[model samples]
Target: MPSSWLAALEDEASKVLPAVFFEYFRQGSGDSVASTDAAAAWDRYRLVPRVLNDVRDVDLTGSFLGTPASLPIGVAPTTLQRAADPAGEAAMARACAGSGVPMVLSSNASTPFAEVAATGVRWWLQAYLPEERLLAVPMLEAAVASGAGAIVLTVDTPVVAAKRDGDGPSALTQVPPEWLRVNLGDAADAPKARDLGVRDIAWLRELTGLPVVVKGVLHPEDALRAADAGAAAVWVSNHGGRQLARAASTAGCLPGVVEALGGAVEVYVDGGVRDPMSALSALALGADGIFLGRSPLFALSVGGEDGVRRLFSEYADGLTEALRLAGSADVGDVRGLEVREF
Candidate 1:
């Protein structure tokens, strides 16, 4: 079951957004088994709370790639935000800035990097390297010039995955091309590089002079390789189950990736993180931080900037309550809490 607050927000979004647009944001590739199972996977772990420790004060403040964040949560990259609201990525950026959390802008974002950075949110730019790596040079250059804190290279999508039809008309077809990727300009149709390798990690880092975080890693060996390739962090994801139909959920894959890195680099996870328990579950399982994909869009659909702010507030409150109940005063202490897989 999804958290009541999140379910309510989603229900509200369904009423507010066009059926096609809503379906586009909600649907995953192929049979949808991975997308459907992503959230439920986190519920399989049982957290053993410690007692007798004082939890008078709980601090949610943390950092992502060494940049301070008010919370350990971030807004994961999603495409075509204009489909959600007129303010689009700018609205999301403002909310993230107000809440003092980080937001990762998508390569397909409707808003430009400079516009997002102007909001003063600690932001990272996500990219899908094209077949000719130079094709991404302009986008990357713009990101660095706009003061992006890091570069998040999405590794799962060599090519766009096939989505199951009949989820109303595709949002891609419904939204105008101009509203889809304002950042790419004329190169909007650039194809993603299918030959991504470990060397690409160093290439991005050296090129941008920003810490590179490799997203969409599930296998421990792959995570280790990314670390050896000098990734500042490895994000455990399956592209929110939009890439592979039966890929393992990030929740299921996080521990192995964490163990593989052995504190060599930061680890983050996304997909199906609906509530405080799910967020805490990821941390107790060894994730340095957690992110929300659909939930933030749902919030945007309902109340634009304020909706996102409220969503973050709810998570912060819920996390504080959970930490108090578990007798942990801070996020780092939550990592020491025991988690058992059933």
Candidate 2:
């Protein structure tokens, strides 16, 4: 919309990809008001840049779930990545590996965990527990065996919300069933457990022996509950407004989630974090890390692995510039940077 390269890429991708596929990646549930309003929500926060401090040589290096990363940004898990490119999640893994960043692989990934792990990227596995919790075990076990560093249990999607019907068939209809759930194999059709509770956090930890990041948390109380239940982190998300309509933006929910955790556990956020300024704002509000969802998918569609690499490069450059301008030498300095709602 604003003539940025990212905007141009989105345009290019829409033209190249199938209409249903593009719509699947871009659309939200119901009337789509929540998805439409998400990015703008970040704009309400006015950054108060500090003056008279050494601003040269800003660093963007950070860690996710105790693992070192080259940048504060990580790729959020998006389902059916192959819809964007033939290489799909493997290409994303390669790009993230090359950039020294982490990636969260979707439970419903088109590619298998072994192939993604072969890229050597620091990665976490995203899973939705089935009504029969054991139905998720084999997949989770395989992911861990393939080098998944953490388990990101997506807690929001108990049931996939109804998307507004598009002009043609849905994207999933176009994709082969085999390509949609390579991880789950025969159990791919199992329903997500609607009765998910905080106990599932410990269950996942015991099952995988990996730190569990409870994703899809919006309320501070939910964040606290996850922390108390032994969650290593609380991710602020509304499933990109796909799970629920009119949900609060992650940018709006982040501060409260962080404050509720009170530094006891890590806090991460995704949704509508399109630029460096928004990313810095999240850090200032005490977020331990920031993630990108559709942005990376858009980039993947435009240039395969290279497109994704270029996108991360732009973010790194932009974030460095933002940090220096805000008088911060590294990401840590932005932890409590001043912000005001405009």
Candidate 3:
């Protein structure tokens, strides 16, 4: 894990990840528009800095759904980390452990659960809705036995949003066979949520003894809906601008969610989170924590473990600077300040 690894990973991503992922991960129309929007919207966002306060110690530690992570920053779980390195999830897990951050382990991950848990990082499991109940149960069991502290039941997809090229028809051929072949018992043809909801997850919460954080929340009504259904946390995200296009910025949607969740649940925000300033703004707006999704992948694709490490390091350092400059000593410190929205 050399200090220079991130630069290398970014270089690699420029060549490989874009072409392959654009086909496999990106959606057409609104989805494709969202990708361009993500780049432009993130570029236009600037942090309003504060000054002249006794800012000696800046603490970024916080907990999401009872798990104590090192900083306010953590990984947001994209797909195909293996495409970047053989170590894949293990490399990312080790980097999180080294940085004292938590990581969301995706159901789409090529690395097995036990291998990820063995890294001693705080493992948070994510499960795509399996079309069949039979396939879903065992993986839920895996999260408990494998030592996952929380289950992030993702709620965004009702169907795989089709790339404009195929229009909801089978585009599986477009996915390289070399990138195929992995599973948690028929994880192939994984179900795209027939009707995702809170009741569907209550049993999972009961089974795991770990908190369940529902991801993909955008509406305040949905936030209320999830808390009522028994989620310990609500993650406001647009699936990294890949799942849906022209979606409201997750940061732009947190306050209404916070108002809806009231005081009973933790609220997290993700999407278009490209830097510490954006993260700081989300936290100040009402998010208890923020999720770092694509940047690390960008980091991983360029350099491997070291690249991910540098990405987290830069984010953590930049966040601490944000806190100090904001006249806030910790994540909680920013809450009392009045935000000036333009």
Candidate 4:
């Protein structure tokens, strides 16, 4: 297996994928402070392991949103998967299915919902509201028909970030027409970032019987509001630090956000979480599950479906080892483990 997603797979993907496309994944907004700091924030925490806990057989399996997941990690919603391989989201779907995990398909997926959902993997749809209500409705309908079990409604990107740094137009614009047209078709469904408050989340719940998750929440107040608005889960993220330049890392704010929710709803987080120990720390702090953004795509880019499967297997193994070393018997035992600032 590859040493680490960053050290091996992503580095190899940089060479395999187009230079501009690779930059799109590599570059973060402004000074890239939040993106770079997310992992460092995790490093600041020191794990205090308990002894003689009998952790000989660590179990990584757990339930996510009522579904069985072999690991406490899930692939995050990312755009333009076809850029990595022609198989696109379909490849990822099969990979996740084989690995016994769920995948959140991006609203901007180049492949149609039906194609990816056909893989029979437990899947969720991540959507951004377009300016037109008509566009949003049909996409939701399609996701349901395609067998999506949940809806992750992103609420943070109310507008394009002014500090976003990158050269030239989005590589997405240059993508082949077939590859650029979001699964919703070419009817100008490009989401016009706009404000969405608690009411909108409530409306979504009424509209879809499927579990609704509010993503991109950084504040405990917003998380509480999400719970009030009927969100089944709250995804704590700063958009991988791409949305806000210096926003607090998800790890730094997770404890506060989780405390605010007070377990009113399941809480998940993403941002600067790339490896197993980082994942274990988040679980200990209170995240129900962890998400991987750029790393999975890098895996797909370097070795397609096989690479992704390998990545998931490696993560599960690494996490199991982390649990054992921390004297945890299983995923559940990880919660409330002793941890403090370094």
Candidate 5:
């Protein structure tokens, strides 16, 4: 693996990819403030370490929604991964499976569900609920047929957000034909996109035996409501600031969501998590798991599956050192670390 940082990988990807695909991964919605600030917000909190606490043998092992992972991190779903490399979602699955981590496959993924599932990684299917029940049902059937362990309903994204200049034409021209087909059959049969409500959570839960997770929730009450509505988990996210500009950062919203749920259901968070330190801080603040969106895509662009693996390997190493410094032995010990906000 190359000894390069994520920023360097971003630079490398920029040089190789088309301007459209490059901008798709590089820029967030509306001035990119929410996306940029979400990552920068991690710096606002300082870690105050405890000394001489016998921090030997730090453990990174953890479980999400009853699935064990080598680390407490999971890959957040991103679209058009094939744009980064031909292997696309398939490469991501192999990387996560090799590292014993979980990955959520995006509904908009370039590769079909069965092909990616063939990698044998523990994965969850992320879906956008269409207004038409006919369209939504078939999508769920595809996920079930692929053996997805869970279904994550992205309640955010009622309609596509306004893209920054250059995102549309570039994505349309550069993206592969197969990449646009999300494994669900017949574009003509597709349903209109609509808003998701708490009742939909129950409706989805009744249809499939798999556990249902509500994603894109930022409010504490909404998190609690998801749990009440039969959701197995609540994922706190701001859609990587791709939907709404100037939205609150996921990191900022995490604590309240965690506090509100009070362990009734597992809680996961994503948005601007660039490295291990930020990931560790999220665990300390009560998130059961954290997800990486842009970083993994950037890594994929630089080296395909190998690049993605290297990124996870780097995170594991960084987290081990961070655990020792924070005087924590494992994922469980992370919550006790001293965290202060400026």
Candidate 6:
């Protein structure tokens, strides 16, 4: 409803990006829920608006594990950014750097981490760990050297999700022949992808000094385990509605993880978040931070860095409105929101 260039980027991306990328965000795991999860999670309450309390300037700046963010939100790890533009991660990094937003770089990305990092990327490396030490070891070390402020270790794919179709062998046939090989070596879960994901994170903590956050946690118990295992933060996510359909909403999962952390570690979330309403709803449900997935990819598909800026600004404005409407003036004030218990 709020007008901004972000809607324009989504419109342009609809025209340029491949059908699959658009479809990826169109459908989500939360659609299966019979009721509006937002209604159950939060009251449709307006922030008893104040007429003139002299609230002129709004600050969108914040930090994610000590890394600066132009806004409280930042880009989540989406597979390949280069699919959208030649600069890809480089453009994203520079743009986020310019905006003071932290850009989390994907290990599966098309652009090398070094290139993005060179542009002063506030990079948070995301990886899937392997059982083998040799493979995981080097990647963790490299992330530190790459100037990543933190490491987000993905643990959900203990094996990849079981999709209804084309997820198996059929997926290979889907790639166009013209698609160039920018992959590190091969597809994920190979000897390399797995190795770097698993134990290397441990080494990264012991060796590189970059704080590691465990991604893909959905249950409170797992969040507890991750914190015990040296995770500075735990992200409750289902892979941007792509990995699994009809899974629990990340918003639903956030409360438990936040409690499990007991304020010892940060609890962040990503999933089924398509707007600022959902954004504020998530924070209301007790998430220390929120991560946006498909939105950024679609933004990249349309206009690269400019598209990202537009989308992010839209989110910031949305949050501002949500805050104002909800009667909260800042991200911190969102804690007292009345949640509808089911």
lDDT of 3 by residue, 101-192 (tens): 88998877778788888998887888776666566777778778988888898888776654455444333454444344343556656656
Model 5 per-residue lDDT tens digits across residues 127-244:
8877775666777888898899999989878876776755257575665566676675553246646767888888877887889989999999989889999999999998999888
lDDT of 6 at 45: 28
Which regions in candidate 6 have their CA more than 4 angstroms from the true location? Answer: 1-12, 20-54, 162-201
Clashing pairs in 1: none
Summed backbone clashes in each candidate are 0, 0, 5, 0, 0, 15
Candidate 2: worst-modelled 10 consecutive residues by lDDT: 1-10
lDDT per residue as tens, model 6, 131-228: 55455556666667778888888876654543333233332234443232333333344543433333444665887687988888888887887788
Candidate 5, superposed: residue stretches over 4 Å from native: 1-4, 186-192
Alpha-carbon shift of residue 227 in model 5 (angstroms): 1.1
Q: Which regions of candidate 2 deviate over 4 angstroms?
A: 1-3
> Candidate 1: how many backbone clashes?
0
* Whole-model lDDT per candidate: 0.89, 0.89, 0.73, 0.84, 0.85, 0.67
Q: After superposition, how far is residue 305 of candidate 5 from its true place, in Å?
A: 0.5
For model 4, the local distance difference test gives 0.84
Taking all chains together, each candidate's TM-score versus the true structure is 0.97, 0.97, 0.87, 0.95, 0.95, 0.82
The regions of model 1 sitting more than 4 angstroms off are: 1-3
Task: Name the TM-score of candidate 1.
Answer: 0.97
